[model samples]
Target chain A: MSDSSSILGSTAAPDREAHLTPAANKLYGLMAEFESPAQIVAAAEKVRDAGYRWWDCHTPFPVHGLDQAMGIRATILPVLVFFGGLTGTIAALVLQIFTNAMSFDLWAIVWVRGYDYFISGKPMNSLPAFIPVTFELTVLLASLTVFFGLLLLNGLPRLYHPVFKSQRFARASDDRFFLVIEAKDPQFSRTKTEAMLQALKPLSIEALDS
Target chain B: MSTLVIDNTWDDPAKRAPLVLNHDRFDTVTAEICRVNEEAKPPMAWYVTFGISLALLGLLGVMVMYLLATGVGVWGNQHPVMWGFPIVNFVFWVGIGHAGTLISAILFLFRQKWRTAINRFAEAMTIFAVMCAGIFPAIHVGRIWVIWWVFPIPNQMDMWPQFRSPLIWDVFAVSTYFTVSTLFWYVGLIPDLATLRDRATSKVKAIAYGLFALGWRGSNRHWHRYERAYLLLAALATPLVLSVHSVVSFDFAVSQLPGWHTTIFPPYFVAGAIFSGFAMVVTLAVPARSLWGLKNFITLRHLENMNKIILLTGTIVGYAYAMEFFIAWYSGAIYEQFAFVNRAFGQYAWAYWIMISCNVITPQLFWFKKARTSIWIMFIASLLVNVGMWFERFVIVITTLSQDFLPSSWGYFTPTWVDWLTFLGTFGLFGTFFMLFIRYLPVIAIAEVKGVMPQADPHYGEEGHEHESEHAFGFQPRRPEDKEEDQS
Candidate 1:
């Protein structure tokens, strides 16, 4: 209860903190609110240098350099999407070749045999005829991977987060910038993290509910 | 209007015009865009337009019901001209969707910053237009319920669609196009939905937007992968746009008919798709920006840029027409020559000329800066381009089908009331989706638009942003700080 005691009431001079109220419950993290990208990007550098693992800088938009400032590495999404497309390509080829040119038993609930059907005098195993569908399937699977793959990686469609429990965190989608160092982080401490955040000169720092 | 147009914007790169006008801040952009969705009362035009669209949609539903009950006989697809109004409408709608994907994918790849303001709306248009397009083919099969036969899924009939067939390729092409485009559109929308969720004034608004926002917290960690995923989608969607229209063209070009079979169809159709797609974007944008007070974001410069694209693609379409004629004559194939000559001078010459004038001559007006910047001129030209593109599909489908090789089975295909109403009803379907879109969703890409602003730069204020951002990482060396101020 003492942790969230309107860290607001204690640090009310900044005026920008007028809208920020840290709700009381279990201490989730320490949140530092900033007014601009410059401030947060600078603050992020210090936080990263402080060696906290479970810290994230939130902003209204993707700050151009904040990733580099935080030492974030490039993602493996492109490689994943590439393999995803290859799977689609292989799937399309097997589906077409087996269904149109070769006979094979495909098992589902029961056996469904695919027999070759000769039509329009084309060869039984024509690759040219199959190219269009193959291309479509390649794109379809690659895109699905990008879509679902991105969400799964991001841990999205999560309806609730402890940061969302903070009234000031609403501005994360608006004008303000935020630095959240979760209590679960090994480097996160009551006095030290709050002191490091205070040294960044953010308008306000609040202890959010878990 | 002239003041808003911002002519002479490029005398120097140092004093370039801002993409978002009126010196807007982050909150203002959100406020301006979110106000429309948050407002309890929309303009009376929203009501009137939605009413008309709903009525037209009702007409389409009735016509489709009539067709389903009475059979494809209710429309005028007869012996020679079997691909009548339905095929024409199908190609036209599909082509219209190309602009949306082109804006979202191709322009984004090219790093066109202006697209951020309009891509969301255009992509929404693409999804809706594709939905309208799917209706015709699904119902065109006569046995509406058996339409799944188009896909390769094994049914109890134990049949596979002929992979060698262009029609079967079209089935795969369009369904895949729809699914991928919807994925791309929804992926782009997730961030904005989070904005709406945060800005929600009511519990229902919160729930609706929250469900879609997927608990986005503007996390840089998430954005790192999200940005990569977006780039991947854009790369995938770019070729997908070209292939979709190309495959649709294959439905005609792969056929043996003289007018229908042409190697040039793919490029020509893709060009025309971009041409008409830009036209449709301008057509939707001119009214939307004005209606929603989004003039600051969807500025005239964006419209002018779109007009230039229209001019380019339209001329390409014209060249394709001339090439088609020249190729037909040069082939020394009598049927091909007859197809070209008859198209220009035959009984259906009126439709051919309408296509030429609207698709070719109309966009020529954009060569004049006055026409491109003038809202009225560009809007009318866009409308004309749309009309011309529709007739181009018509001329292609009808001329080729009506008098191909056998004059014995020649039939002048006239669409019944069902065909006319059904086509018009698609407009209703497109409009209804658009109306709903503008009503609830953020029409502009809120975060993306913010990303382009100078304020988004980390070193925005201090030594200016552009200079430091020359580094690929946009990282700048930190300056010595005053420890006294921090300890104050």
Candidate 2:
């Protein structure tokens, strides 16, 4: 048996399209729900063509090719991660050389002097021996860059998003696929948007607002 | 090419194993994985196991206190056998962590969909196991107070750590490994955490989950970036995993000791690490699946596939053992020959045999499908494999250092009560973290699991919808109270 959560509210506001005043409607957006990926993907393509730049499609997981449907360009996260790794490699290389090969008083909170020495009959500046730490540092910095870069790019650690306003959108992380056309979209006309969403034949539609 | 588990009544061609079984809709997959965390109480066995773990954790605490107060002399580590139980435990626990990384990082790169079911669990195990592993090394330095010397922060002593030493390399490798693994695990948890945040039944749960969820709304724009970052992490971790174990092996291979100084050690150690790590995974997964009703998610196919890897890696381990002996004898060096002969037939011969039979012989049973699929057989074999692996580390450490090249300086390494308790207590440490993890977090990656289901495909509705529609009942929407939970 299904829990109470599984019972979805099917609010079909089809006839309520386009007559309301702008002052009467204070909305985050109109979120159109569909049961399957095919529906939402097909609907996303239409929304993209209609010039809704601020719109987005929400799904439970990474919907393959949905980015293409929404016309999302490939992220520059990997390129940044590469530079991050490069920084780490140079940092490790300099640190090891400065400490192991030559002593220098560097600036931080205080001037800390590097201790140059030799051991294991190996050269004072041993590149082969330094590779392991360098490699690990490269990976460490690259991984950190990927995570922080993603958060910065995505504008995350955000406490709230307007999409969470709709009770229907709760299923966005579960089964439902939602196409949200924000009120802030330049092409947004309250009446015209609902009329366009109606043409997509969504399972349900919600006009969400603060 | 993406593999789809078709509704295989007839006319199916690709014939790959189903990733998720008996679940038609995406939400049910969410429900099942979340149910374990949302339930008010876990099964009775959880309490029993948790209690034992806590008590053992207490023992570990007491032993650490005693060692710090008294001295390193409380352990059996003496002149020749300076690296004893602590090093053995360190290597064993570290090696055990590799399986999780292999599952999470390597398999993900290879696009193995089955990894989604168990990757979270394995990664959690990796972090906890590393924590236990870290404790042994930190304490074994004999001076716990000046442990910061491991770092390159300039000190009043004007002394820096030896950069060319394998020991310093290990410090960097392991700490870096731990940090990267933790970040990787957290990143994977974001979508799943958001699921918990949305479906949270309480205010506290919602806030806590929401904070970590980082306001993930599964937007295509965000998912597009998230997926790319995840791929980058996986790629970075794949090499990190190999390097971590190879650095650990360098702790031995770079040594002048006859048994330890072999070029074969790196690949051999990596293979053994994966072998033992998979063994531990099976051991943990077997009881866990049954206890949590996760059979459908971590299906029989997943277990069978793991058993196949165990068999493959286990054989490689055996071959390495044979090759080590051949390499030792072929070099025609008296000390190398003596080291190999002494390992097989000398003082530590008993421990060597345990390693052989447990690691080599036990996994060979998986060649039979009955052994692979049977819960009892695989579980027992896994337990044996863990024992064998621990002994494998024991044999490598103690045998070489005990007698080595000088018979007069020979010593028999034996564990003191503190040493034994500390080693046993790490299991408790590992178990405690694991128990809390399973109780709180979605034990499986809910979002990743859903991604593999057929319904996630854009064309799922177009292909054979009739077969799925019958079972796609109760597939939509939220509970009445969900709004209050969210708004609160």
Candidate 3:
């Protein structure tokens, strides 16, 4: 069950032949395993060459430099976070402006039956009073931006995925390493795909039959 | 021709008890260590925490009911001291929150592997602390029901919250902080939840855990995305943590009040937040390690590292205190000069001394390695730090306001019984959440700690040898058994 030997010892490099068994895809795909970080990276590169735009690399821990090596771009979550924070700021400003400057203007001007009360003779729309709200909005928006943005960016709440169907995939969370190329990738073909993956020196190659 | 002694850290294989490979071995080890006996189902520590937390929670509940039934006027918030226990509690909880972020984000950036054991708990504390913090400000508002007025909306009442108000800014700062902290906690929990889901016995636990796990099959694809997101969150959170506290400090600094107005408030507050936060972590963690029998997991090395930070930040905060006094003297502004003078030798001189002893003197003991590593000593020091920090807030709030610009307006502030009860309640609330976290969630982050093992950490390839030494010291790894068949 350890299967460490098969994963660690792949000698038939770039074996170009394909044995066709349509039913073998699910089990076969999982049989092909990765033992080291280097092998996973190599498989990822080949996955990219095979034109699979959407795929991932899984490991027990964060694999250093995997994102760049896998050619994943910077996330849009930051920009989303920025916008959320911007909204918080604007909301804070408008609320204060309406309440203190516009809404309360008449009372301020009237000044309790013309008995003059002055806070350093400052105007009704005092910008100084707005500091707290401005500070709060900036924080509010930015925090929300990060929170909701992460969820949307990750497409979370997904209760199922094709990878979950493979029992071997579970170890990817604990000890194993994996490189999964989605079937939706443009250049995905049975024979050429397996050949390309074999060249990348995985333990073995298996099609995701399902 | 090279004759050099290359002493490996892990010298021998099979030195310690084998790693607990099967679920049964792991569970038995935990049950024994955690003191789960059928006759005596709950441990003494459990009773203490539960009883204390429940009593505190009851006090909080009753106090909150009174506040709701009457008004915020129940507590002593009179002239000159407009912000009282509510603001103090708010600041204290926020400060408590700072340690978690310091542990999770800053240490994460530095790749300090030692943090793995406590980061999960630390982050949980952050979320809970923030939760407690959020409650204070909500009730601080006189019309608690209309708290939504702080939000920006074109309501039927034709009103908007003041944009430039420091209070409004706090609302945003705290809410944002809460959101980000929650997400950070949840994101970190996903993999652990998946682990639990796979290991679940009952159908309900499996389904519940599975749902939360988000169908995470640990595909390379999912991990690739998850890691990217985690790194991004840590990056975002680091600055956010600093800014959030800076904004909190701005609540006081932007004011022209004698003690409150200062340019250095932002950095000063942030440093103090971290200082107070690390102190709280030690206060909580020392007891937790002993009670949970996790001495090996939360090692002396970890305690030493935290103590070093405590000392460094305590010094920085002390420096801030000195600089503030010096600047006040140099400015020659009568108001500022009087403020500093009154704080040192005025009506609240006792509070000032407490702050000095707790914040300044206590952390100095950490200068010695022996003191830092000694749990009892560190615990006492941590308690002093908290006491000092609370007094620091009290000094800042009370001393400056007690004597304002006008001689006629000078009046001393006093905390009534209500203030004491409410303050005590918050402690109850904090303890309640922490106890709950310990009971349910994996307190030690099994996966993360396992990752730090000799087999896991490639840099420390000889960890296997240290097992025997670890056992002699009264700790042993779980016995190994194959559960691979069940897993596959």
Candidate 4:
């Protein structure tokens, strides 16, 4: 069984590579490489005008309005961050209140007294006094929540990506921009997508088979 | 073969890039950059920085050595005034440290593009300021060796730190602040180190950068995780900065002292911290850009923007001052009223006027666009802001301590040589760190700066847009071309 699975996986790798070769379809979607953010954005606008929904823009840095230009909105992470923050707040409040008010008080001396002396004209259980501790707990919990929560929320820790397959993708960190229209987009027909992407006039365009 | 199938549609983590900077960029900078990297060593601006910072540092070192040799009896704290210059300097330095984190973390979280130019240095200033601040408290305790008593340690005596004490909270708050800020600063350095790593030619430089870079290879997955984590840290730090200073303020306000016990101390201290912090940034940045020839990167628009913050925070601080006075008068408390009056006209009245001149009068010039943009004027204003902030602390600590409930105990306090030396020495310590930071670290975030340039962005093409493009990633649009270049 193991040998069969290994054989299947090895065979699939070549099949995947062969499927991604651009020679299979010269009319594949154009992948424009841009040096400037402006070109990517302008091309994105032109593609939008050309009614090409399948095309995408890429850059080393996130181009402003590029998302809106490409008509992208709202990732799944923010809602996740919100829930994480909320949980953090709740957890902080509970833990602090329990620890301070209940858990570990050595009240042997105070227990005999029916009531405790209230100073500064306030009762023993003043909410305001609890504020500092509550706030500290809130911050502590919220911070941990955001950090780890973001990690978990984003489903991270895996260490590979398809963009890494493109050697030029490294320039995204320095001074380069990119835009590609995937074959998967509903509007992506090979010929029309190529025509639409060509009209935008990027620095260079290549067909990316994935 | 009865093979079991696994789900591939669960959002494959393999789709995301592992890191941000790849091997190519790193290799180029490492091998070719120092010689060809025109921006590496712009010109001879360090002479001026070294001269001033070195002199100040020398003064500080001499002062601290004197204090350590002598005792804690030096600067002004007496029987009723257990905490004077040391406490005042602690608060002042801590306040000056606020702007750095506030600018780097809070503004970064808000997606302010203008922050890119100065945030690196600003964050460094924060660390240095905190260092200077941590000193006063440590030394003020006299037997510095036993300062560990402030920590909640399970020792042979079996005594725990008083949980309810504000001073205990401050110990946690300050330590937490320093740790977080250091982490934040180093985390931001990782990418820049990769840039340097790629540029380095010498084996030692390569090793240094490599070690700092921690095997970073600009994989997309790395960027995704890094970006998210950075944002998360920024979010955490913003609240921590606020909370730390608020706890610091609580140290005085929680105590039932005549002028010290006020509800307004937190916001007041926070405002002053931001004000002094901005002033310190301006002071350093104005000189730095001119000295380092970073006119294009650290532009005049950056100065103007910082000035705007200085003006805003300064006003808030001024208002807090006025409010304190008003509250004192409104409450009909003689001691409170007397505290304000005495602050303006007592033995430390000179300090009060200096504070007024620096805090209130100087920043007002920034209301004018011309004044805000002028490097010289901004520098002077920044200097004044520091002086004023110091005096403000002096006024607070001294005035309150000089006169308490009993008129019989009300005696004038003066700083001995020890107090002065330690104060000076701490300044030296801060200057040394800052000087070293500027010399070594990429004082500006190279990648972040490149990100903000006009040509780097995808929207602007070659024709009319002369040079560069900047990217506005998450929130507020960040563009370098939008910045007004520094003429100086």
- DockQ of predictions, in order shown: 0.39, 0.39, 0.15, 0.09
Please give the distance, in angstroms, between residue A141's alpha carbon in candidate 2 and its true position after superposition. Answer: 0.3
Better of 3 and 4 by lDDT: 3
Q: Write the per-residue lDDT of candidate 3 for residues B269-338, one digit (tens) a residue.
A: 9999999888888888898877766665666667777899999999998999999999999998899999
The candidate maximizing TM-score is: 1
Candidate 3 has an lDDT of 0.68
Give the per-residue lDDT digits (tens) of candidate 4, residues B1-488. Answer: 14422211123454521111222232232322223232456345555556666777787767666667777666667887888888988998999899889987888877677787788889999999998898878877888777898864435544444445688678768876877687777767766765555445455665665566654444322344456556767887888889988999899899877678999999889988999999999888887766665655566667788899889988988888888889999999998888888888887788889898889888999999889878889999999899999988888887788888889988787887666666776776787778777776778776666565544444445565533343333443334433221111
DockQ order of candidates, best first? 1, 2, 3, 4
* Candidate 1 C-alpha lDDT tens digits along B1-488: 23544443343667656677763479988888999898889999899999999999898889899999999999899878999999999999999999999998888887777798899999999999999998988999999888878877777777888889888888888989999999988988888888888878766677778778888889988877787788888899999999999999999999899898999999999999999888999999999888889888888888989999999999999999999999998999999999989999997999999999999999999998888889999999999999999999999999888998888877787889889989999999999989999998999999888877766767776754462222211223333441111100
TM, every model = 0.93, 0.92, 0.77, 0.72
List model 2 lDDT by residue over A57-120, tens digit each.
Answer: 8888877657667777666787899999999999999889988888778766477778768776
| 10 residues in a row with least lDDT, candidate 2 chain B | B467-476
Cand 4, B chain, TM: 0.85
Comparison by TM-score, 1 against 4, better one: 1
Q: What are the lDDT figures for the candidates, one per model?
A: 0.85, 0.85, 0.68, 0.66
| Candidate 3, DockQ score (0 to 1) | 0.15
